[model samples]
Target: MIARARLIGVVGFLIAGATGLISSTQTWLLVSLSDGAAEPLAVAGASAVVLLAPLSLTALALGAALSIVGRILRPVFGVIGAVLGIALAILTAPIAIQAPVSAVSAEVAAVTGIRGESAIAELVAGITATTWPAITLVAAVLMAAAGIWVLATARLWPEGGRRYQSERAERRRSGGPLDAIDSWDDLSRGGDPTT
Candidate 1:
């Protein structure tokens, strides 16, 4: 169960982060102009939520770090992940529910050279949300659940391996004789291997 929990937490965060990053580059809303332009203006997730890409990157980093960090840091990372998930949800939920005129202001400005909230609102005939926002919301929920899972099962996870420890530390712990590799390591560190 411990191993399964660890796997779940790691995999869940990874998938959620990847999906969120991908969705951030996708269209989240379509804005129709009151003037009846041939095509509607597209508002990307990144424009709608500027923090989306950064938050997703953080989630990816957190997932990678969680796999190798010791028990002490697990809960800390878990808390960060939970907060990130909630933040993402908070930023995305409003746009998903009803995209405000400000959400498409950038696209409108770029296309029609119109600026300001009122100006963009005047040009926008309707705002329709795309599927990307829904997908991002689901990913946010999964990320939060994975974080909570980590917090609950951190103590049950196995202790981190000592593979990253220096050979001298390993030898001291095991009381083993120094090997050729240890001699090379000592030499590389400006120590007298003969000593």
Candidate 2:
């Protein structure tokens, strides 16, 4: 059913967004000192946001929006979200490969309390030896796949239920004894329940 597809799509986007959020906080760069003490350059999701905000934030917002909007608009947003995910993946590839030498060096210098050109060079070398960029790439791929799934199946989603309807509409229909009570209350307040 379309409703089921819509639910699945919503869940997919949510999972993708959650993954991206988690990936941002993960350690993207690691620095090992000469003494064999390994330290993280940036350990929070906030640091990753500096480099991946464009992609991560967009996916989060789109996923949240998809849950509220009607079925007809789901696919359109899905495609847009998918494109953003791909862009994120593309942008992340190089950072993952090269390890952002300068940034990592600066972070290492700050963390290790090292203050010499040679020391910085050694730290940079140590930092670059590790691989963390793959995290972002994986997150990006998940987001893209979720978006694609939504785009592919949105057309089959069912219409929203009465809960999505306006409050006024709920008062208009004559149901059981409760319906008369509701209409009477609306009329007493000088409000047209039918409207």
Candidate 3:
């Protein structure tokens, strides 16, 4: 069961990661294609916002979905969520790191006609444009946090499952006569709830 969950999670993460990169790349390319029709600064600002928006949203949506899904499964859900979250994070990091670097570099080149000038400051400005960096950071943080929640939820997986398995086994091992006697046995038996 855990193996199945792990497989499903890996497959889902791969699908999401691959599609996300391709789609995001396409959109950013579209933004770049807006070259001659508009002012460079507006184009830069607008495109930066556009590129960062969905990455942040995707991260957020993944986190929420993972948490909800984790709660439903109550165990393997965490492992699944964590695996998917980390895989997607690794897949998406290049683009997240790229946006500010690329856009700011482009604008800086367009404005100052220079290669690299105060790259750090430009990263800050571009990242802050429309507060997209904050949004992105929040989303990434949430994804990791949700993964942790899921991982923690699985701590009882072994013990609880083992207890249930033992009771079921004891019942299964009892004969047909015992099966017939089971209701009477329960009625006659008295024991501590703590056990």
Candidate 4:
């Protein structure tokens, strides 16, 4: 059970790491492609780190939850939550980060008559300007919240013997042996196979 949860958690972490990198890179790519494209401030420090932070945290949380819960808890909700949260994060990161970046760009453009990624700047302005993007932002925030809730629910959800058995089987096939670990009887008998 613990083995299965660990496996799922590790896979979740890997997926989160990979996707986080891609999204973070894309954020920079979007920024770089903007008018002037004059490297954004602290590209490595701010952009990459900020973007990757959520994914890493989410992954860690999921892994920890799964491991703690063992096979009793499934990661399906975590997966869904992560997918939605990641999508919302990816969508809104630019909105959140770029909006400020755009403000700076606008000021710079106003002063120097140089536009770096004017299109992106305009988008930033448009996003931050008024009701439209604000509404979208709110929705994105709601979605992220829902995703978090989903993850939490997944963590707290209970499991039946069937779920435990399947998860244990999965673990046995992958990393550990089936017989090495005791079944429900072991739990009742107060035996610890992992020890």
- Compute each candidate's TM-score over C-alphas: 0.82, 0.64, 0.33, 0.33
Error of 3 at 180 (Å): 19
Task: Summarize candidate 4's per-residue lDDT along 12-106 as a digit string, tens digits.
Answer: 44454444444444323223323454543322212423435465455446545554554334446455545755564565555555555643354
Candidates, ranked, lDDT:
1, 2, 4, 3
The clash count of every prediction, one per candidate, is 0, 7, 1, 5
Cα lDDT computed for each candidate against the true fold: 0.88, 0.67, 0.43, 0.46
- Candidate 1 off by > 4 Å: 162-195
Q: Candidate 3 lDDT (Cα, whole model)?
A: 0.43
Prediction RMSDs, each to the true structure: 3.7, 5.2, 12.3, 11.2
Give stretches of model 3 more than 4 Å off. 1-37, 40-103, 106-128, 150-153, 157-168, 176-195
lDDT of 3 at 79: 57
| Highest-scoring model, TM-score | 1
- Best candidate, lDDT-wise? 1
**Could you tell me the lDDT of residue 77 within candidate 2?**
88
Q: Over the stretch 32-117, how does candidate 2's per-residue lDDT look in tens digits?
A: 55655655445333453355754666777888888778867888888987887788787677667765555455555667787766
